[model samples]
Target: MEKFTLESQFQITGIGSASGLVYKENSLFIISDNGSFLYQFDIPYNKLTRIPLVKNAQENIPKKDKYDFESIALKGNKLHIFGSGSTAKREKEITYNLETAATEEKDLSKLYKKIKQTATLSDEDLNIEGAIFFNEKWHLFQRGNGANSKNGIAILNDNFDEKGTIEFILIELPKIKHIETSFTDAILVENKIYFLATAEDTTSTYADGEILGSIIGRIDTQTMKIDFTQKITDINKFEGLTLYNKTQDKMEFFLCEDKDSEVLETTIFKLTLDIKHN
Candidate 1:
C-alpha cells in the first residue's frame, strides 16, 4: 500500500459547509450543503464568486428548505450536483452546463426508491455523499451513516435514467476507534478511484456527531477493490476532494472540510501522496 502524507493545509475563508468540490480552469467549484449558491474560488486572484443555483433566491436557503447538495461531479461539459437523499427534500439533482451556464433540475425520488430496493437499504440508510463519472458509468457512494451502517456503491448508466438498471455493491471500510467510516466524497484520476471517508459517532443520517477524523483510499477500477487505505492525522472532517496536480512519483489533492456549522468559513488542505515503486 502506498502512503499518503499531509504536505500543507490552507484555511479558505467566507465559505460554509462545503460538501462538494471540483477544480477546473484554474478555479475551484464548491457547493455547500446548506446554501443555495455554487462558490467559485479563483486560484490566482484568491477571489470568491458566488453563483446562484436558483434565480429567485439570492441568499442562503434555510436549513429546512435546502436541498442538501452533497456531491458534485464534472462530466464533459456538465456539472452534476446531487442531494444526500436522507430526506424527502434531499431527493433532487441539479445539472449545470459548464459551457452554456444553463441549469436543469430533476426529481430523484424514483431513482432513490429503486436504489433502496436494490440495495435492500432502509429509508434511514440511504444517503449518497460522493459521486464520479468514470468509464462511462456513474458511480455513486452511499454514506451509510444511519443505524444500518451500510456503506456501498451504486453503479448506473451514464444517462442516469431512473428506469435503467442500477447495480449495488456493499463495501466494508476500515473502522476508526471501533466506529465504521462512511463515504464523504470521491474523485477519479486515471483508472483509479480516490475517496474520502469519515468516522462520525452517530447513527442518524440527518444529524451530525463527533467526527473521528477522515481517511483517504484508492480502489482499482478493474477489480473494483480497495488498493490501500490511510487515515489522515488531522482532526478536520474532509468531505470534499479534487486532484490538484499529479506527477510520476507523487499526487496532490485539494480537500475541503465541513465542520457541521453555519459559520461562513472553511478550510482547504493540500494532501500529498508518494507513489510507491516496485
Candidate 2:
C-alpha cells in the first residue's frame, strides 16, 4: 500500500493545543482539550476564530491536559464534541446545533457504567480518542497501550448508544524511536475505514503528551482486514483529521496537531492510493 505525503504544513496561531478537528466545506472546526473553546479555521486564508463553551461548562472544565474534549464529528444537524473522559465513570459528550452553535451536554455516565460492567473495557488504558460516523453507526476507537496492546472499535448506534459487542483489531505500526502508536482519529469513506494514529511521550494519562510521530491505517470492513498502512514522519501529534475533498486519483485531508504548548500545527495533505491492490 502507498503511504500519504505531507504536501504542506502551517503553524496555527492563537490557540495552544487542539485535540480534534471537524470539516464543513472550507471551514474547519477545532476543539482544544486544554481549553474550553471551539475554533473555526478558514483553511485557505489561515484565519482563526474562537467560540467559548457555555459559561457553566467552562467552569467545570478539568484543569488536567487529557481530561477534555478529544474528538469532533458531525451527524445531520448536530455537531458532537466528545470528551476524553478522565475515567470510564466520567465520560461525556456535547451536541451543538450546526448552524447556531447552541450546545447541550449529555454525561455518558450511564453508558460508561453499562460498558464497564460488561467487561468490555479491561483497564483504564481504554480512552475514546477518535470517532467517526459510518454505516449508519458510530465507530469509536480506543487508544490502547503498547506491548501486546489490543485497540478496540466500539459500535454505537446513531444515538451514541452501544449496540452489541465491541470489535477488536490490532493496529500494525512499527514504533518510531520505540514509542507505541495509538489510534487518534478515524475517517470513513464508503466501505473503507481509515484511522489516524499517533505515538507520543507522557509520564501519565493526565499529562500533556509530547507527540513523537503518527501513522494512518486503512481497514477493509467487508473482509475485516487491514488493507494499507502509512506513516507520517514530520507531524508532531495529530489528534484529529478530516476528509476535505476527493477525486478519482487523490484525496485531500486536513489535520490539527497538538504542540504540547500553546499553538497547534495545522496541515493540509493529499494522499494517493492504488485501488487495484485493495
Candidate 3:
C-alpha cells in the first residue's frame, strides 16, 4: 500500500475544463464548456497555446447553454473528446489528431438510433463525463440527471462503439442523499484506475457550493470491479487526471482543478506516491 501527497499546483485560465489529454511529452490539450476553444499548455515551462473550436459543432448542438465536456481518451495518435449535450438528442464524440490536426465527429444519437432500430437496449440516457482506456477497452462514466439519477460506467470498443450494453454501476454516496454526484475524469496507472467526482449539496446550486469532495477508486482489471475506494473531502472540484511514469519505483498523479479563483486559480497537483509492500 502507498500514500499520496500533493507536490505542485498551477493556475489555468480556462472555464469548464471539460476534458484534457496529454498530447506531447510535457504538453496537455484542454477543452472547455463555455467556448469552442482548445488550449494547449506545457508543464513546468507553463506555455499556453489556443486552437479554434470545431467548425460546425455548434450547429448540431441543441441548446444555447454551455455543454460540459465530460471525458477524454487517447488511442494511438488520435484524441477522443466526449461531452454532455444540452439535450439527449445532441450528444457527440469528437476525434482529432494532434500531429496533423485532422478532426472528425460522430453523433451518438445516430448510433443509438441505429442500435435501437435493431431492437437492442442502448443506455442512451447516460450523461457521460469521465472516460479511460483499460484492458483493450474504453470505460465511460456519466453524471446522472435529477436527484434519483443513477451513476454508472459503460464499456466501449476500440471503435468507440458499445461493446454490448452499458452497465449501471450505482455509486452509493455516504453523507449525501442524492446521487447527483458526477464522476468527471479518470486515469489508468499500472493496473489500477483512479477517478474524480463531485457531490452537489442540497442547498447548493450546480454552479455554486463549497465544491469540496473528491474520491479515488481502484479497479481490478482482471475482474473489472472496484476494489478500493477512498474519499478526500478537502479538495475542490477536479476535472482531469493523468499518471506520470518517472522512475521504476516512483509514481506521480496529476490532478486538474476547475475553479474560478484568481489567486489559487485553476491548478494542477503533483502527488508523490510512497509505496510499501507487506
Candidate 4:
C-alpha cells in the first residue's frame, strides 16, 4: 500500500492533549483527557474554542487523580465520553447533548461492582481506551499494561445499560517481551473495522512517551478476526481516529496524535485509504 501525506495538519491550540474527536459538518469536537475540556474547532479556518465538560476533572475524580479521556463516539444527537479515574475499576461513560450542552453522568459505580462480582473485570483490567459504535452495538477496547494479560476488546449494547448482562468478545495479543502494545482508537469503515494502536519497545505508561510508529490493523467484523496488520512509521502516539466520507470513492481518515510534551499540541492528519483493494 502507498501512503501520501496531506498538506493540511490541523493543530489544535489551547487544548493539552486530545484523546477523542467527533466531526460535525464544518466543526470538529475534541476532548482533552488531561484538562477535561471540550474543544470546538472550525474546520476550514482552524479556529478553536473551548467548553469545559467537567470542571476540575482532575480534582473532582474520586481520589483526586487524573485519567485519560480515551475515546468518544456520537450516536444521534448525543455524545458519549469514556474514561476512568482512581476509584474506578472500569471506565465510566458520560453522555452529553449536542444542542443543549447538558451533561449526565451514568453511575457506573454499581455497574463496576456488578461486573467485578461476576468476574468480568479485575482492578487491573479497567484501562479501557477505545470505543466505537458498530452493528447496533458499542465496542469498547481495553489496554493491558501489566503482565499475564494481552490487550482486549469488548462489545456492549447501545445505551451502555447492559454492562453486567453483556458478554464481551475479547481479542488477546501475543506475548512479546519488552514490547508494549495497546489499541488506541477505532472506526467502522465500509463494513470493515479499522483500528489504531501503538506497540512500543519501552514500557511507557504515558501516551506521549510511546515510540513513534504505525500500528494500524483491520478486523473482519463478520469473522471477528484481525485480518491484517501493518505498521505506519514516523507518526507519534496516535490517540483518536475517525473515517470521514467525502464521497463514494473519495473517503479520508482523520487521526489525532496526543503530543503533550514540548509544544503540547494535538496534530490532525488526513489520509486516503484503498478500501477496494483491501
Candidate 5:
C-alpha cells in the first residue's frame, strides 16, 4: 500500500496550541487556538516572531473570550483565519492583509447556522477545523467532535459581501482504536485534498480528551472520496498542516501539534510521503 512516512520532525518553542498554519514567501504563519497573537517562523524553523492579533493586549486571551481560531488559508498576500464555531463567541471569520497590515473581522453566526441546517447537523456538531480556498470557493471542514460526530465539508461562495449559496458534503473518516477521527486541518495541492485529523476520546467540542493519535489522509476532489489514510503518530494531536516542498516522487509537509497543555511550547513536524499515481 502507498503511504506517507515521518522522515523528520522539529520543535518550535514559545508557541502553544498551534491550530492553524499557512506557508508563504519562505515563512510559516501560525495561529494558536487559544492565543492572543499570530506567529511567523522563518524557514528552517530558526527565527520566530509574534504579531498581536488583539491590539494593546499584554497577555493571552482568556479561554471563554478567545475566538478559538482553528483553521487558516492564504490567498495572495492575504491570510484568512476561521474560528471554530463551537460557541457563540467562536463565530468569527478574520482576514488579515499582509501588504497593508490591516485586519477585518466578520461575524459568521448566520452562516454557521445555515451550514448546520443544510448539513442536517445539530448545533453541537458544528466545529470547523480546516479551511482552504479552491476553485474560487472556500471549503470548510467541520470536525466531528460532538455528540452527532459528523464530519463533512461546507462549501461557501467566494463573494462574502452577500450571503451566497451553500452546500455540504458529509464524510466518514477512518477510526483509530475504536475512537472516531475528526478533521483538524488540511491543504490542497493539484486536485487532491490532504488533511490532518486526530482521534480525541470526547464527544463535546469544548472539552479536551485522550489523545489517541493523528492521521494523514488524502481525498480525490473530483470523486469526493478518500484515497488513502495512514496513522502518522501515536500521540500529539497535530492540528496544522502546510506544504513544505514537492517533487515528482516525493512530497514534504510541515505539521504543527497541539498537546493541550499549558507549557506554551508547540512542536512542528516534518513529514515526507511517496507520491503515487492512481
Candidate 6:
C-alpha cells in the first residue's frame, strides 16, 4: 500500500480542458474535450506543443461541444482515444499513429448500445470515462450517473468485443468524504491499479456540475480488493492521470484537471505517492 500526496502542483496554459492522457517517447500527449488539437508536453511540462486532429469533416469529431473525449488507452504506437458514451450513444474511437499522426475512426455505437442493454444501464448512467489496456484486453470504466452512484468496468478485446464486466462494490472502496464520485481515470503499474473517483455536483449524464474533488485508490481487478485509498481535496474535476516517475520508495504522477471554462481553465499538476501506507 502507498500513502499518496499532492505535491509540486503547476498549471499548463492554453488547453481549455484536458480529457485524456498518454505518453509516447518523452512527450506526454493529452487530449482536450473542446478542440481538435492533441497537447504534447515534455517531462517538466515547461514546453508544450499542440498537435491538430481531424475536425473539419462532419463524420469526424463534431464541431459542437457534444462530442466529449474522456479517456485514452495506448497499444504500441496505436493510440486509442474514446468518447464518453453519454446519452448520444455516438461512441467514437480514434486510433492514431504516434509517429506519423495517421488516424482511423471506429464507430463504437453498436458495441456500446449492446453494453448498455446488457448492463441495464439507463441513458444517464451510461457514460464510459476511464480506460486502459491490460491483460490482452481494454478495460473501460463506467461512471455512475444520477443517484445510482455505482461504478463499473468493462473488458473488451481489440475490436471492442465485450469480454466481461465488473461493477464496483461500494463497500469495498474507501469510506470517502464524498462517496458519490464517478470513476474518472486510471493507470496500471506492475499489476497495481490506481484510479480516480471524482464527485461532481451535477445531476445528469452530460453536464459538468460543481466539482467535489477526487479520491485516488489502488485496487485489484480479480478480487475487487482495495489496498489503500487517498482522498485528494485540492484538484478540481481531475480527469486524467499518468505515471511520471516510479522509484523504489516513491511513484510520481502527472494529474491533469478539467476545470470548466467558468472558474479556472484546464491545468496539469504533479502528484506523489509514498509507497508506504499503513
Per TM-score, the best of the predicted structures is: 1
- Candidate with best lDDT: 1
lDDT of 5 at 85: 90
Off by over 4 Å in 4: 1-8, 56-64, 85-90, 113-121, 162-164, 172-180, 201-209, 246-250, 260-264
**Alpha-carbon runs more than 4 Å astray in model 3:** 14-23, 56-63, 111-125, 161-182, 202-210, 233-235, 246-250, 260-265
Segments in model 2 whose C-alpha atoms lie over 4 Å from true places = 1-3, 44-46, 56-62, 65-67, 88-90, 117-123, 146-148, 162-174, 201-203, 208-210, 263-278
RMSD of 1: 1.6
Instruction: Give the backbone clash total of model 4.
Output: 1
TM-score: model 2 vs. ground truth: 0.83
Query: Positional deviation of 230 in candidate 4, in angstroms?
Result: 2.1
Q: Quote model 3's TM-score.
A: 0.77
Clashing pairs in 4: 214-232
Model 1 — TM-score against the truth? 0.95
The segments of candidate 1 whose C-alpha lies over 4 angstroms from its true place after superposition are 7-9, 58-60
| Candidate 6 lDDT, 23-133, residue by residue in tens | 656777887766656667775647877765556622123434446778887788877788888756338888778878888888888778776776677766777778888
Candidate 2 lDDT by residue in tens digits, 161-245: 6545544454555566767677788877777887778877653445555677788777888875777777765456777787876
lDDT of 1 at 34: 83
Worst 10 residues of 2 by lDDT: 56-65
User: Model 4: per-residue lDDT, tens digit, 1-278?
Assistant: 53434434686656666677887888787776665666788988879876666655431233235545777888888888877421452246677788899887665666445433343556544556677787887777766543324466666567666443655566754322356456778777767887877755543333234464656677888987887765654546677777766454445778777665424467777766554545
Q: What is the model-wide C-alpha lDDT for candidate 5?
A: 0.85
**Model 2, residue 222: C-alpha shift (Å):** 1.8
Candidate 5 or 2, higher lDDT: 5
Q: Give the 10-residue window scoring lowest on summed lDDT in candidate 1.
A: 55-64
Q: List the residue pairs that clash in candidate 3.
A: 70-129
Order of models, best TM-score first: 1, 5, 6, 2, 4, 3
TM-score of each: 0.95, 0.83, 0.77, 0.82, 0.94, 0.86
